[model samples]
Target chain A: MEYLIIIISAVFVNNVVLSQFLGICPFLGVSKKVSTAFGMSLALVLVMGLATLVTYLIQNYVLINTWFGEKMDITFMQTIVFILVIAALVQMVEIILKKINPTLYQALGIFLPLITTNCAVLGASILVVTKEFSAKGVESHMMNLGESVVYSMSLAIGFGIAIILFAGMREQLELSNVPKALKGTPIALITAGLLALAFMGFQGIV
Target chain B: MSKFKYLIDGIVKNNPTFVLVLGMCPTLATTTSAVNGMGMGLATMAVLLCSNMVISLLAPVIPNKVRIPCYIVVIAAFVTVVQLVMQAYTPGLYETLGIFIPLIVVNCIVLGRAEAFANKHSVLESALDGLGIGIGFTLALTCIGLVREVLGNLSAFENKFSSSDGMLVFVLAPGAFLVLGYLMVLFNKLKDRKKKA
Candidate 1:
């Protein structure tokens, strides 16, 4: 039940893109078409989930663990270490995917490189370590490894849904006449505001 | 080109927010108030200045194929430094900016300048470029934050004029998008007018 609430809240009520604004770059850059949006969404889910899991282990074990009879706390290195890890992980994923599965690699190849700079992946990873999660009527506590993975994957799915839906809107928008000054990105941003307004209605749910 | 031109170009012609549209995440996320927006922009500027100078200095030694990662490491180091300093000096602002201070590592503006201008230019020119772009970004963010704060919270730089509450939505998620969209149109019109003149 708690996990379900987390998923609902993440996907609708507190969407990563619409509400939090973590991945606005890709949310705007890649949402021109539904097919492309779908591709980016899949890539995000894979990377966000994997990155969160790895960062969680590192944060718990290496950064804040006891070492040689002394409590070690170098959590400040969290930013540098996680970024390098995510970058290396993305590269490794690209290579391994090419060797093992050619077609999947072809589909996600371009976006994989782009994912390294996508703040949503890094933001979600950091959130897992820093932010505490609580469901409705439940006491808030730090998320364990299992919950963090679920939360990160759900956040990616939420991002996917928002971007895909926005792409559909943009597809139709391309046909309509828009003011000259607000032709491309400006109009898209307004449309996203409307979408975000609609999503805000779900705030009462969780 | 003159060194000063690089700075002016970043502020006007190549303004990161209004023109290049880089670093949208921080522009939208942290600009709930004027002070918050300016804070985020200045923090980003500090990182950009340091990373640009350092990267330009190291461009010769870093392998071409691995320059991106090298840049990321340099950026991450400075971001860490900024994060620590902000935490110590301005804990309130630090609390508000939260994950964004670290996420500056991925901000396209910093990395974009490094790849585009810094590596190709002398250290002094790159630093000037960083300052120009940083000022441009800072100005843009402060503008957005001022608009949002006034319209949403009925305040400017945390000074409340009408305490009864403004639109209320402007401080929320949807308002950021709406305000930025409309501002983009306004900026384009101004730019077009300048071009015609």
Candidate 2:
């Protein structure tokens, strides 16, 4: 039940894109078409989940620990380390995906390379380690590794849903006669504002 | 001089926030208030300027295959430095910005400028580009922040516009989107008219 609540809260109450504003780049960039958004979201779901887990381990077991088995808090290195992990992870995923599933890889196209720089992946990983969680009026310092991974997965799902929906809206929007000034990105951003308002309805769910 | 043009271009022509539309994450997330927006922009500028200069200097040495990773590392280092300084000196802004601070490491504008301008240009030119773009980003955020703060909270900077409640939504997440959307439209309209004239 707790895990389910975590997922629900992540996906609805505190959505990664609309509510939190984590990954607005891809949210605005690749969301022109539903098919492209779907592929990008799938890649995000995979990369965010794996990258968070890997970063969590590195944070707990490696960055914070010394070779002498003494625990030293070198947590400041997290920004650099997490980014490096994400960059390397994206590379590995790209190669493996291309070899195993050429069709999916082709669909992903330029987006796969662009994922390396997506703030959502890096933001989710850093947030998992750094964010403090409070349960039942008890202020827990930070999320445990398992909780972190689950949070990343659910956040990615939320991101996927938001982008896919936005893409659908943009597809229809392309046909509508928008004002000249508000044609491309401006109109899309306004649509996002409405979408965010819609997501606000979920605030009461959790 | 052409160097002067780089500076002017960043402010008006290729403005990072309004024109190029890079770094949307921080542009939206941290512009809840005038102060927060300025703080985030300056921090980003510091990182951008240093990384661009460094990347330009090292471009010849770094292998093409490894350039992106190298650029990221350098950019991340500068972000960390900015993060620490902000935490120590501006604790209020630091606490408020929170995760967005570290997220700056992934900000596309920093890396985008590095790859596009810094790698190919001289160190002096890259530094100028970073400064110009950074200022442009700062100006854009401050403008957005001013609008949101005044409309949402009836406050601009530290001063209150009125005693009564404002639209409240202007300070919220949705407000950021709404304000930025209109601003983009307005900017584009002006640019279009200018081009026609």
Candidate 3:
């Protein structure tokens, strides 16, 4: 029941993209078609979930203990270290994707490199740090390791849902002929606003 | 001098958060209240300006192969100063900003500027560029802060000075998204209008 609540809240109430705005770059940049959005979303979930899991362990064990080797604490290196790790991992995935699936690689293109620095990935890392060490609240109290993983995974799923939904809306938008002033980013943003307003309904539901 | 152009570019055309969208983690994370927004923005601005100048000064001597690592070292050193200064004097701002202060070392805006502008430009030009962009970021984040604090929380300027109790959502995570999205819409509209005219 607790894990279910987390999954629900993360997917809806605390949505990674719509609610948190963590991945707006990709949300705006890549959500052109549902199929591509689905791919990117899948990539985000896998990347963010794994990154969070690894970083949590590293922070608890390695980051904290690096102070012992040197009198000067270097935990301040967390951001660079995590970013380098994520970037390297993303690069590895890019290589495999290129060799294994040229068509998929072509589809992903610039977005693949972008995944390294995507805010959602970094935000997930920070969230792990926040969730684990930060003072507990009612919602956070229910979370354990499994719950944490599920929540991050669901949060990424939530990101995909919003992205794919927005892509669907944009697809429909291409057919409509209305506004001259609000054409590209403006229309997309307005659509996002409506989505956000709708998502607001789920607030406090948990 | 031509350096002023470098400065103005950061403040407007290539503003880090509002325009370039670099280093958004801290911008979104800390801009809950006007106070916190200003605090974090200024803190990062200080580090950016200082690091840029340092990197630019060393750019001529530092080998290109190791440029990135050297920049990171310079950035990390300044970040340490920021962390210690915050820990000692402005504990309030320090506590509120939290991990973001340390995270500034990796903020793409700082690193990007170091590699892009600072590496090519003179030390003084780099400093000017950092200051301009930093202030622009400050302006953007503060605007977001104003919107979130007022609308989500239903009170404006609650934390301009040190006051604890106010509309909590302004400082909450959801409110950050709300403010940023609306502001983006508004900003986009303004730019569109300017282009039309």
RMSD in order of candidates: 1.0, 1.6, 4.5
lDDT score of residue B189 within candidate 3:
73
Q: What DockQ do you compute for every candidate structure? A: 0.93, 0.89, 0.25
DockQ of 1: 0.93
Model 3, position A192, has a per-residue lDDT of: 75
Highest DockQ model number: 1
RMSD of 3: 4.5
Per-residue error for B159 in candidate 2, Å, reads 1.3
Better of 2 and 3 by DockQ: 2
In model 2, where do residues sit more than 4 Å from their true spots?
Answer: A135-141
lDDT of 2 at A159: 96
DockQ of 2: 0.89
B33-99 in candidate 3: lDDT tens per residue?
Answer: 7778888888889999999999988999999887776787788788878888888999988887776
Q: Which regions of candidate 3 deviate over 4 angstroms? A: A65-75, A96-110, A132-145, A174-183, B17-29, B57-84, B98-108, B151-156, B159-197
- Using lDDT as the yardstick, the better of models 1 and 2 is 1
Q: Name the lDDT value of residue A62 in candidate 2.
A: 87
Interface RMSD of each: 0.5, 0.7, 4.0
In order, the Cα lDDT scores of the candidates are 0.95, 0.90, 0.75
Q: Model 1: per-residue lDDT, tens digit, A108-150? A: 9999999999999999999989998976776889999999999
Descending-DockQ candidate ranking: 1, 2, 3
Comparing 1 with 3 on lDDT, the higher-scoring candidate is 1
Tens-digit lDDT track of model 1 for B60-102:
9999999999999999999999999999999999999999999
